[model samples]
Target: MTKEKFKSLMQEAGIKSKKELAELMGLHYGTINNWGNTQGYPTYLNNYFHFIIKAKKYDEALKKGFDESEKPQECPSNVEALSLENARLREECEKYEALKRALKEALR
Candidate 1:
């Protein structure tokens, strides 16, 4: 999502900053900032997008007086969220690998 949309999500969720939202949604502070802007690679960007979407869905459900525990949650569960985060970490690793290859090429 665009920075403005992400910011709007934060507002709609009734939070002030990424840190607060992170705490509320159990997301890493960095993940929220990554959503705010491109951090490095857009590898797991979709995961964050899905996460925010799910959170919004959950919030909407609550507002609608739905019982979340008995209902099917379209949002990413804990495992799914972790899996998405793993994709992000893998992307970070790839960047380092690319840098390493560049260094090796330079030495050659």
Candidate 2:
């Protein structure tokens, strides 16, 4: 991956600087900095950064209640299925809480 692309991915993942990326990835700051002056970032880093970006998106979506309409259409089938299941589980939890509340009110 080109240095520019790596930086872009880091930014997309909410990483502000090479130091932050290095800390998150558990690498030395110099190692991350060397990528620009060396041959280039390792090819695997491309996948890693992409994964980080996806995870960030998923985390944000989860925080927003994992609404089905908010799910990305471009996600792989497995990811899509997981998102659906998460939505289903959230619904179940809501139902359970409502039932618990009703039962408590009845007992009272």
Q: What TM-score would each prediction reach against the true structure?
A: 0.34, 0.58
lDDT of 2 by residue, 1-108 (tens): 766787788888889988998899899999988997965778788889889989998898787764556665545677889999999999999999999999999999
User: Over the full model, what C-alpha lDDT does candidate 2 score relative to the true structure?
Assistant: 0.85
Candidate 1: give the clashing pairs: none
| Highest TM-score scorer | 2
Q: Give the TM-score of candidate 2.
A: 0.58
For residues 40-88, could you state the per-residue lDDT of candidate 1 as single tens digits? 4245544655676788888887866555566456444766988999999
For residue 70, give model 2's deviation from the true position in Å: 13
The regions of model 1 sitting more than 4 angstroms off are 39-108
